[model samples]
Target chain A: MEIISFMIAPLAATLILGGILVYFGIHVIKREIVFIDIALAQIAALGGTLAIVLWPETINGGGHEEGHHLIEYLFSLLFTTLAAGLFSLLKSKKIRIPLEALIGISYAVATTAMVIILDKGAGSDVHIHDMLTGAILWVGWDKVLRLAGMVLIVALFHWVFRKNMMNLTDNYDNSSYKSKRKNWWDFLFYFTFGLVIVEAVQVGGILTVFAFLIIPASTTLLFFSTWRARILAGLLLTVILTIPALWVSWTWDLPASPVLILFLGIILIISGLVYQIKKKVT
Target chain B: MNTLLFLGPPIVISVLLSIILGYFGNHILSRGIIFIDIAVAQVAALGTMIGLLVGFGEESLGLEMTSYFFTIVVIGIFALTKFADQKVPQEAYIGIIYCLGLGLALLLAERISGGSNFISKTITGNILWTTWKDVWISLLLFSLIGAIHVFFQKRFQSISLNKSENSSINRTRLYDMLFYMTFGIVIVKAVPIGGIFLIFILLIAPAVSVTLFTNNWRKRLIGSWIIGSTGSVTGILLSYSLNISNGPAIVCLLGSLAVILTLWVILRKRTVSV
Candidate 1:
């Protein structure tokens, strides 16, 4: 009962973030840019590192000064949103560079920059380790409420721009100036996406954020066909995975993020194996 | 001036790694397995980490053996992954393998103190600290792999570039395994010396940069080697001057060059059409 009570806020937040991530995962899978979450999350991390560096006494210091957390959050959001815009622009048909490689490059650079910054003693007094893996097991109700608010705003945006989102993911219609206008919509999509991911990354860490963004949707793709079915299956799996993962983490005293990611992998592999066997038999 | 002397051997090693990686990178690109280098490097790092858990030091023979052992396992699995439906994107499998490898490493790292640092270390390792002995070993291993590749260059090229050739599924799998065998060897050896970031950049950046200029494989190989050498030298000098880590500096520099060349290609094509 104690453990469950403690886990309530974190669990709720993880589920909400997982659902949002799975929503983005659908577009990511369709666009075949699966690793964008990792890249953007790392960029967000870079922003956090920069914030901590610039305001040593404010963010992540012993005392959480008023508005410091917001500044850090905005810094992260700013970097991620800009990266999202750049990624959208790079989707220009004329550029022959594979977007995945570009994303991978950015991820590498961001991670490198992070290590260098951290090495500079910017996070000397703080346990900046959680910036990447995150402290999910330690999230509070206030954080969850804030995430819920962001989730609602993003959900409303998706509902309103549902048609544009679908077309951007599926159509690949990079023909003319009209497509360029559509690109701005895509930028808006990624910008809002960056906003969503920034909060999730703060709560769940990059690993969990990536797992939620990728595994559920990818696994659902193996099982389902339609968008509605995929999202439903993904959310169902996220819930199913989350409850036991939290239980296991609480019981065994393991880190929740890696445990959750490993479970997702196990589910993906099992589903993949089953799908392969079925294909082979039939 | 003293920094130049001390950095000379490592620079040579980096240049050699860049050339060797650039050579094999064409095949990786042609196969569209863009992330295989990192994937393989991660698996190999897991091997090394396992070695550490078993109480072997980083430079221990035991660590090297275990690293090679895990590399072999990952290579075999990656090769067998091809047996799946071709319609199903291979990237899914690769992505899953990468995440699993990383997640498992993190999990294992829990048992060992400061285990998580190994993950970042594998990505951007300390290239400037590599020893002369390791450099020679890398050169020899690369040579052996290069010999095999050179001997079977045509067969490998056909299998990599023209996938839908006259070959049965079994035969194709065999060739891929062979390619991965050599690839595994290169990655396992190079990773310890150059780190994953430097190796990945050398592997893809030069090969990719070459493609912006021409499609001919021979030309691309030569062009890649040249770009790789110059970029590596430039990156090393910058790292030395700026006092940053050698591996990541090279990766960032090369990454910048690849982006520039890509943009130039795009702009030129746009102007041409206009």
Candidate 2:
């Protein structure tokens, strides 16, 4: 019972974060921009690293300072917003380079820039280490509640703009449907995506967040054809995977995020195999 | 004088990377598998981490062979999975492989003490501390790879440029495996010295920049080499003058150049339209 109680917050955190990430994952898969999440996450990390460099006291002393956290959050938000804008702008028809190439370029640059900044900053070793490995096992209720609130707002925003957003993604290749307003909608999609990524990355690190975003969605995609079925199934898959992963991690005293990611990867592979077998038999 | 002595090896190493990776970068961009280098590099790093778990020394030949073995397995998987009928795109598989490799590496890193240092090392390598011997090895290996590519330039280009539709599937698959094997070997060599991010930039940025100007194969390759070498030289000089890490300095310089050139091309289009 005590262990169960300890697992509650993380379970809730994964469910909340996982639900939204799966939805975004559907869009990401549809748009053929599967790698953008990592790119944006790296850009947000760069923002946080820059904050640390400019205001050493923000993260130098090791104690949690509310103002410092806010500064870091705002910096990340600013950078992600700019990236969202840049991404939307680059999607114009005139640009001949593949968007994937640009995304890869951005990811590499943002990551290297963070390394450069951290090399000059104080207490970089700790920050770099922390940036890579998430501390999901130790998350508290307060953080979970905060993330829930943010997820709720973003969820509502997506709900309100569902039709336009879905149309934009569904009709992405239709030249007639593409418009100036579509650019605004694209920016909004990427902006909200960046928002969710920044928060989820801080909680679950890059790999787990990526696992949540892509693995379940891709797995569900193999079995379902409709958005409704896929989203519900993806969320269900997350819930199913999260409980056992968390339980195993707690039992073995292993790191929760990577364990969860491994579980997700395993499930994805199993489903992929099943998918292949079914395809061959049919 | 003192700075030159200290910085010479990394500079030479960067030039060597430019000469080789710039060529591979062209193939990568043309093939449209832009993230494959990073994915393969991450998998190779996982191999090394597994070697560490198995008690191999850091620079041991056993670890190097382990890394090569892992990369070959992954390259084979990539070659086999290039089916045209799969619902999921190849990019999705690339992303999944990248995440899985990284996740497993992190899991293993947790078991080993001082593992975070190793993880960070794979991301941002210790290029400043590179030695003359390392430079020489890179030079020799790069020359060998370059010669092979030069010899079979047409076969490789036919595949990369997607002009091999008449070839048998098995034959094409053979070429695909060959391509990724060489690409994988180059990546495994560069990752420890330049790190994954630097290798990614080196593999993509120069190709993107040069392709913006020309379409001729020879011209594109030469343009990429010139652009790559110049960017590396300037980036190293910038790192020396500004007192920053060597890998990131070069990455930022080349990355910025690619972005700027892209913007220039865009603006030029606008002016022409106006």
RMSD (CA, Å), each prediction: 2.7, 2.1
lDDT by residue for model 1 over A1-282, one digit each (tens)? Answer: 798799898799889988888889888777777778777878887897798778888855666676687777778887987798778766767754567777777777777676666764344323434654787888988889988999999999998979888777877544533544786888888888888887787788876787788788888887687888999899999889898988898789888888888989889879888998987898
Off by over 4 Å in 2: A56-64, A173-176, B271-274
Among the numbered candidates, top DockQ falls to: 2
TM-score of 1: 0.92
Clashing residue pairs found in predicted model 2: none
- The models' CA-based lDDT, in order, is 0.79, 0.85
User: DockQ for the candidate 1 complex?
Assistant: 0.44
Q: Specify the CAPRI tier of model 1.
A: acceptable
lDDT, candidate 2, at A161? 84
Model 1 accuracy (lDDT, Cα): 0.79
Please report the candidate that would top TM-score against the real structure. 2
When candidate 2 is compared with the true two-chain complex, its DockQ is: 0.68
